[model samples]
Target: MINMKETINHYLAAWNEKTATAVKAAFQKCCTPDVTYTDRNAPTYTEEGGFVIKGIDLLTALVMGSHAKVPGRAFSLLTMPQYFDGHCHYSWGLHIPGQDEKAGWDYIVYNEQNLITRIVGFLPEQV
Candidate 1:
């Protein structure tokens, strides 16, 4: 079980920086080597059943794909510290930095190894 608080913090920071490299690093740290980012129904590629960005190269591609969409977005702790048996899932109330309002909910699923396996995200709501 990993404390995602720190990981999420770095991710949100990297997003605002628009530094693709930083985001990539954070993702690599939190996710496994075979990490897959699901871009289901995303504006860019809602036609191909979403993209399965595998490995570091593809992970960076996925981050680049989302760069233009959710610029300056920051995540806020929502569900707090949660535990499920030995695994855990948590949600965050995302906010666009400088926007100062709740954007949407993003979920992160972590395994016993403290590596993220799934990432479920939604577009920001009216805020």
Candidate 2:
């Protein structure tokens, strides 16, 4: 069984480490092929069979672009203490350079085998 907390931290730590390989590895370590995602206010949204994202490719693009913005951003879980209706809730408090502190819960939907298939969370506007 995968430790959800560890997995989440692993992904976030990659960004803080500023290693592109770590970032990509983090995604691979936690995400599933059917992974889907969504932002709070996206321009063009599409159904990823779960939370609405422009698309998986778009998610990748956005994440990739964020790396260059003053490296060392980290997402720390603030509080996430429940599991119901097949969705795990995780409240995160993040510290990112050039960006104000933002916090929100990520709704993770795990695949049948326990890999993260989709996640939806709130975030602030990026410059």
Candidate 3:
């Protein structure tokens, strides 16, 4: 089995990548070619699957956009990842200089080859 911590690091590397070429390479190394991804605040949805982005290309684009939207912030693990039955979840925080950190959770599914196949991200809602 692949080391879960290493896998999680690679996953975050894609999100923290500084350039388009590097981000694409980071994602291709850690995720399946046709991986699926969705987050709680995604605005668009499909009738069948809700808000989802399928394929590495689309995922790479999404991260690139994130880099544009929030430059200089980087994600860091706030807690160790927990894994079971091809699934893993972890808490993470976005480190923004002179600003409050944003905490979130990621639940990931891995394929038999140990590549990430799906990622479900969530942000806590205020009551």
Candidate 4:
């Protein structure tokens, strides 16, 4: 059986890394070549309403661009992931060098091979 929690934690750690290159490497290691990622709050310029990203190459570019936009920002997990029925959910917070943290959560799905197949991230609703 796959170690669901460990897998999710690895993905989160990759996301929290300081550099985009690290993020890309992490994704390549943990996700399948055709993994799909959807970020609800992604800027409209790069994606549509769903912000769907298909393939590891495209996903790496997206993450690199995001990191370029905010050079010093990184993600930090706020709570342990909750897993049930083949899905995993966890909360996270964004850290910037001189700014307050922004929080969010991600829902992830994995394939039988223990690679992440899809991930959907949701930020707190704006006031």
| The best candidate in terms of lDDT | 3
TM-score of 4: 0.81
lDDT of each: 0.57, 0.59, 0.80, 0.74
Q: Per-residue lDDT for 1-127 in model 4, tens only?
A: 3576677767777766656678778887678889888776455425434478888777776666666677777787788888766688888888767878888888988877667889888876640
**Which residue pairs in model 4 clash with each other?**
none
Looking at candidate 2, the ten consecutive residues that score lowest on lDDT are: 42-51
Best by TM-score: 3
Which lDDT tens digits does candidate 2 get at residues 57-107? 545544555555435666777884355444677777778767778876677
Candidate 3's displacement at residue 55, Å, is 0.9
Order of candidates by TM-score, top first? 3, 4, 2, 1
lDDT at 99 for candidate 2? 75
Better of 3 and 4 by TM-score: 3
Error of 4 at 47 (Å): 7.7
- RMSD in order of candidates: 3.7, 4.6, 3.4, 2.8
lDDT ranking, best first: 3, 4, 2, 1
* Model 1, residue 43: C-alpha shift (Å): 5.3
Whole-structure CA lDDT of model 1:
0.57
lDDT for model 3? 0.80
